[model samples]
Target: MKNLLVTGYRMNELNIFDQKNKAIVYIKRAIAGRLAPLAEEGLEWVLTPGQFGVDLWACETVIDLKRERFPQLKLGIVTAYANPEEKWKEDKQNYYRNILKDADYYGAVSNRPYEGAWQFKARDELLFRKTDGILLFYDEEMGEASPKFVKERALKLADEEGYRYIAIGADEVQSMADEERLSSFD
Candidate 1:
């Protein structure tokens, strides 16, 4: 896929209140593991809805990939509405600002401040229309949060148009953590 939309749990949804949380390392590793091969196969762009957990981390992973391996990869952050970081703490806002500064493209789907849930639905439709595929960090049992909407929409689109969709489940993330632990002893 040329363009892929990546999204998942928000910080609050995942109960990760800070960037220094140890789980972030494994989460990012999972994203990078899946993304590297896609990049090798001509994935040029990674896009996110800027939900600020898995979404922002996915963009960060793309940046890491560009630095460490695939320089051809680009990052995009399109939020559902404007000023996505307005309510966030200063540190989180700064973190998001840095990502936006480094992004190849950054903007909002609605271009206005939050009005209602319809804005997010508009974002989902816009993402489905723009990207060729998706890399979602979601699982059915624990994915009753915002990611569910995106996942559901992506699955329907995949059924209709064969749109490529990859979901990273909790078990896969746990396995990556286990693999890292074992490799550290080697």
Candidate 2:
């Protein structure tokens, strides 16, 4: 069995619940949700804060708990709110970038799918794509898909197109919707 990590929305501040204990409870629930299926499969699941809320303290607590409870689990990072619409808003680009650079694998959870986990951070992957430019338009009506599958397909296209960078934007998006990518399995 393989280990996996699933990420979602999270509020890192203790003030969100008016108590530190409440924050812990919220984190605990999130941890449980990821671990439940992994436990049944005898596979390990590691939980970390989604890109939306990379609470330093909360993140530390989750890591500490994982090390204490399941020291041998595999790790992955989750991305939230896949699109960037607000410039003033804090984006987890930095957080997601770190994970993509360092983690074994990553997944982006959104209405539509993306090509690579690194795309979430737009780090090395973008440079690798050799994109002339990235156009960010606010359609507010574009279709969305699974990040995991999308990323998987992107990688395949990269191999097929002999494009170490970017390839088959549409096909990769389709693969993600079809659930064809599995980076964790790699």
The residue-by-residue lDDT of candidate 2 on 62-178, one tens digit each, is 355455665555454544434432332334445445444544445545535455655555432432243221111111122333333434534564576643221123332334434
Q: Per-residue error at 49 for model 2, in Å?
A: 7.6
Sliding window of 10 residues with minimal summed lDDT for model 2: 131-140
Candidate number achieving the greatest TM-score relative to the actual structure: 1
Q: CA shift at 171, candidate 2, in angstroms?
A: 38
Give lDDT tens digits, candidate 1, residues 1-186: 899999999888888889999888989999998999999999998889988899989889999999999989999888889998999889999998998888999888888899999988888888889899999988787748878878888889889999998989988888988988899999
Cα-based RMSD of the predictions, in order? 1.3, 14.6
lDDT values for all models: 0.89, 0.38
List runs of model 1 lying over 4 Å from the truth. Answer: 183-186
Count the clashes in each prediction.
Answer: 0, 7
Clashes counted in candidate 1 amount to 0
TM-score of 2: 0.32
User: What TM-score does prediction 1 earn?
Assistant: 0.95
